[model samples]
Target chain A: MELFTPDFGLIFWMFLSFAVLFFILWKFAWPAITKMIDQRAELIDKGVEYAQQARQDLDQAQAKAEEVMQEARRQQADILREADRVKTQIIEEARGEARQAAAKELDQAKLQIDQARKEAEQNIRDEVSAFALNIAQKVVRNQMSDTKAQTQLVDSLLDEIEKKN
Target chain B: MKRLTLIALLLISTLVSMSFPAAASTKGEDHGGEEKIDPKEIIFEHLGDRYGWEVPFCHHKSIPLPIIVFGSDGLHIFSSARVEHGKEYVDGGKIFRIAAEGDFKGKIVEIVDGEETRPFDISITKNVFALILTVIVVCLVLLPLRCYYRRKGYKAPRRWLGAVEALTAFIYDGVIKSTLKDKASKFAPYLLTVFYFIFVMNLMGLMVVFPGGANLTGNIAVTLVLAILTFLVTNIFGTKHYWKEIFWPDVPLWLKFPLPIMPIIEIFGVFTKPAALTVRLFANMMGGHMIVIVLTLLIFIFAQMGMAVAGGTAVISTMFSIFMLLIDVLVSFIQAYVFTMLSTIFISLAQENPHKEHGAAEAKH
Candidate 1:
């Protein structure tokens, strides 16, 4: 078999087809394809923007959670402080009442003691005057009776008075 | 009266020149004084008797061009068609010799040796001229259409641009971008050129009945060269991945345990892929052309038998030829697409990075 060969005629035709096709396609088809690609790219950009928005929303949610946790912490501290203040006030009120009751009881006891002391003094003085008068009457009635026995009684009575003083 | 006399003398000379056979100069041999052979017989003997075939061949009678001969002496350049007395007539205006012969001009030199020469003269052939004219027609018609739109102050209708645009979009979306992944646009111009080149050539081949005698695409050499170019471009523009896949394929250790053998086989597979592309395109074009030629030959063969038999066979063969012709038209477009598609596939394969797949698999491992 003779080896097939391409001639000038074939080459010319090939070149002609190439040139014409390239020119026509470049003018007509390329723009549409490029446009389609651009549209696709725009869609991808939109998708990316949406993804970014979602990410931002997530971050905002995280920050809000953090703020709520901080507020809870502050509220907890306030409750703890109020509880501490209330506890101190209750303790102070109890102490103030205890002091007032103790003072009132002391005042009543002093009044009672003063009254008893006065009573006792009066009783002692009256008893002492009666005894003295009785003694004088008795002396005038029985002037010459037993001088030695009277002297012995007076000495025992002196010893009792010294112990009482 | 003077002027009228000169006009009459000029007309008479023109008539006389038309009647007389023009003297032709002989190139290789000199027949000084032998009975002249008829110009028609010489042409018939050279083209028909020698080649075992005859085609209706004609050219502008004004220009006498040299006859091209492929013989044992390689391509023997003759001055012109043999007229009479072993003399040839070459046209002055049309004939011009180029240094290039066949396709490979610079690389492979044509070796000529003295041997028994079977001199056969195949004329320019109407089909060859028609093929050339088709290219011219395409350029003449489409170039102006392109320019009319491109020219300042001229706005072509949307439909006109739309038609051209559709083809461009098809090439870009269908062929180039689909083929060359990263640099589709980079090679879009080339791919587009190739697509349209094959498309137009195939289209011209389809229109052979109009002016051209045979389908130019049917020539195996044309398809082969195109396949070779695709092969070269695919390999030349191949990526690192392309080579890596072939040289060091990703396979199980057990499968590749034969060490050097597996690598060699893989490398061979890479070469065969492009080779298959070459063979496929050449085979398809050649097969299509051969079928058409055979169909046409049947007409001639039947006519050789008896007239009645010839008439009946002619009808059947012509019908079949027409059917084949329609299919051949479809085949032209299909072959062009197949060639382009295979070219794209080969290039895509070449540009693929085997390492990427290997890395992904390794990550899983």
Candidate 2:
């Protein structure tokens, strides 16, 4: 019964003090604490959002770098193929020039050979005709007196002509 | 080796010293005198409110508090020490004494014509001092939380203030926000204050020393006031729909019209919520403290058998009391949480959707 009984003095003081405490807490403390909490939550959310945005930007940069590298490699391959084609064309032109020069040289040598052959043939005919004319004159002068002596002289002249030729 | 021997000797001496309260009985019996110690008085004395603060291990030494009361003759103010030992104080030919028993037991009463009558006592009692101490502690803890938010803004506070922040967020988010939703912000201060107030009082009552053991929350008077505060918050801020639901509930006509049984039950339920709140907190804390005191009383009970038996029982009793005190700490937090949760639920019930009115009216058509 004593435990169940509530003293009026206690009730009076409790009511008074509790009411005062409630007023102070409601007016002063609560607003600031709750505001700070909400602010912190907002700040955290913003931080997470910014991090995600940064990661996305980094991914985009990486992809762009990969694309640039692929383009550069394609350009490099084009330049190498162009260089290879130019080298083959230059080599083909040089081979054609060399073949034309060799053909011209061969044709000039053939013309020189033909001229030398004609000149040699002309010199041979002149020498043979000169030797024939000289032998004929000697035979005619020596063999004027006797027929047997003229025949002998003519045969000797003929033998001399054969040796000279 | 020498230190080990010394340590063992110290342990034996401490255990022997711990058994002295039980050993005192035999010493009394050997002198051919039986000292009868009343366990009920010890338990109730510890639980009851006092005019003076009791000093530990000293029956006579106490801190006197101011006693203020209004008698039939007008207001009277004096020190409670004047009436400490059943002594009568005469002021202006009016005598006052602290009554020992009867209807006005443990109250400051005025003697007139040999009949004891209680004055209107507004004196600061032990429970009141504990209440003031609790209030001061709550302020000390809560004021810093507000300052941390004010000075540092959104950053978390360190140490004990950090614990306070977490507890506040827990009750705000877990209990109030979950139940009351948008109105959580409006009632946060009152609900949060009550939460800290009850928790501090419950924890302080668990302590066995001064400024700690006044049993403030365990006192029926204190819990009654707290419940009344919650009751006032619920009804005072109740929405129109809440009253409509109570008076003209959406049930069948026969229940509310002819019998009015539903309305009666609804009105009865409004009072019972606070009643349940009051009894639940008071009984849990009071029972915890009583159990610890009973376990300590076992030492005196077992002392009647023998000194060795009392020593053994004292060890067992101390162990159990420690265990009980540890469990009471958990119960303290749980009771505080439950009280705040129930208060939040009741407040939300009052703040039930204003949109319900349109739906109910439409349903009638």
Q: DockQ for every model, please.
A: 0.06, 0.50
Candidate 1, position B92, lDDT: 30
Q: Can you give the lDDT of residue B64 in candidate 2?
A: 92
lDDT of 1 by residue, B134-192 (tens): 55654554454444444522232257545654565566678767656567765665565
Give the CAPRI rating of model 1: incorrect
Q: Is the docking of candidate 2 incorrect, acceptable, medium or high quality?
A: medium
lDDT, residue B75, model 1: 57
- Candidate 1 chain B lDDT trough over 10 residues, lowest sum: B44-53
Error of 1 at A72 (Å): 46
lDDT (Cα, 0-100) at A145 in candidate 1: 79
TM-score of candidate 1 on Cα atoms, chains taken together: 0.49
User: In lDDT terms, which candidate is top?
Assistant: 2
Residue B336 of model 2 has an lDDT of: 95
Among these predicted structures, which one has the highest DockQ?
A: 2
Candidate 1 positional error at B172, Å: 2.4
